[model samples]
Target: MRILFFLAFFISITCHGNLIWSKTGHRVTGHIAEKHLTRKAKRAINDLLDGHSLAFASTFADEIKADRSFSKYSAWHYVNYPMDIRYEDSEKSKYGDVVMGIETCKHIISDKNSSREDKVFHLKMLIHLVGDLHQPMHAGKGDDRGGNDIQLQWFDEGTNLHRVWDSNLINSYGMTYYELGDELEESVDKKKKLEIQAGSLYDWVHESHQKAVEVYASVEVGEKLRYQYGYKYNKLLFEQLQKGGFRLAKVLNEIFS
Candidate 1:
């Protein structure tokens, strides 16, 4: 029993440390995009997904991590840039970064001769990558492995800077993705939505990289983060998720329209 308990604890710690946005955050992005998608995009997406909603489809990229064959895609979730360099000026990963992954997925889905199976796979990837792109840590500098190495405490529990932004703050609110999606939708008006959706993909990526710099400056290693931390950063969290959703809709609208 003692050995079993220690192994279980070890696995839990290992898994928790690497997770990206809590499932809730990704689903919220998907749900929000669903609301903003044009009629043509909606129909095309439904047909490609066999009627799966964007919220459900949003998780496919993460879920595939369980299969070793998909291991090559692990790097697709984030892009790293040094503080002094723009992504355009930085060295890109040969295995593919978030930006490349998103672009490739778009190209695949937009090709008329692509197989249905290929289109479905890339569409799911597109949804998930867009959400990942908005996660500030996903734009982290390579030195810290996107803040994964910046260990910290979350309400005194062992965690890290990457996990905190990925899920800790959003999960602390105790809202399901659907609930959060509704709340976000209510909070933003059309003008704000348009503003958030503005900018090219590179512009959006640079925005996230800037936010990542702020996130790194907000705390130090071993800091205990709790209510006060959430209070300070929750608004930024919502804005990123909202922007991700809106921008995803814009991308899909352009592709399927």
Candidate 2:
């Protein structure tokens, strides 16, 4: 009884609805985790890239498909949900852990003996992780799993905090990746691009974390979020996606450069 009480207490204090999102996001990203290329691995990627167009070389397709197939898993399906952990007290929450895991995977993908299968796995994982890491809730330090459990109405449809940010916010913009990509590519100055391209995993995590803080400061969950509100959020989402895709491509090119 004492042990059970202790467990319950712990959960009550530490658990959040958003934990599911991090775990699912992590697992999805793990499947596509890229492998570190040796000369051989580099050669393999080179051969693949040589035959494929850069525009078509994203890991997104494989990732989304995997998410679809694995949607039955609570973890995968829960990407839209937030965990119980908060940034202020629980730095090691699943969401933060997911980021760490991605960083580790990034290194592993570069390992010489990692199999082709593993490389492909990390590639997929990185794709998803890149997306997850940019999510303010994934980087959030609040109790609501970045607001996943915050019950709210999204334009008259019932929704939770996390879901609002995960897809709704992005979808509200009505802009496609191609359109956003062109805008981003044109807007980013050469120096800014170099700065973005030059950073390490730590840099990425920190940047996301900072943005997460900004996002949380801007809004509260449970508030009525309509198309206008959604539109505001979508702009941020577009930038994040654009940054994610560009960084992903940069990482791949560097690996195979």
Number of the top lDDT candidate: 1
Against the true structure, what is each candidate's TM-score?
A: 0.94, 0.64
Candidate 2 regions exceeding 4 Å error are 1-96
Q: Report the C-alpha lDDT of model 1 over 1-257, residue by residue, as the tens digit.
A: 99986776576445644746778889999999999988999999999999999999998888777555787888899999797778899888888899999999999999999999999999999999999999999999888999989999999698888989998999998999999998997788999988998889999999999999999999989999989999999999999999989899999999998
Per-residue lDDT of 245 in model 1:
90
Q: Could you give candidate 2's per-residue lDDT for residues 1-257 as a string of tens digits?
A: 99986676566434333332232222222222222223554465556445432333443322343233433222322122223423233335353355555665577677778877776656555555565666666665545555666777878887766666665665555555445455556676767666665677556656666666666665665677787776566666655555555566566656555
Candidate 1's displacement at residue 15, Å, is 5.2
Q: Which stretches of candidate 1 lie over 4 Å from their true place?
A: 1-19
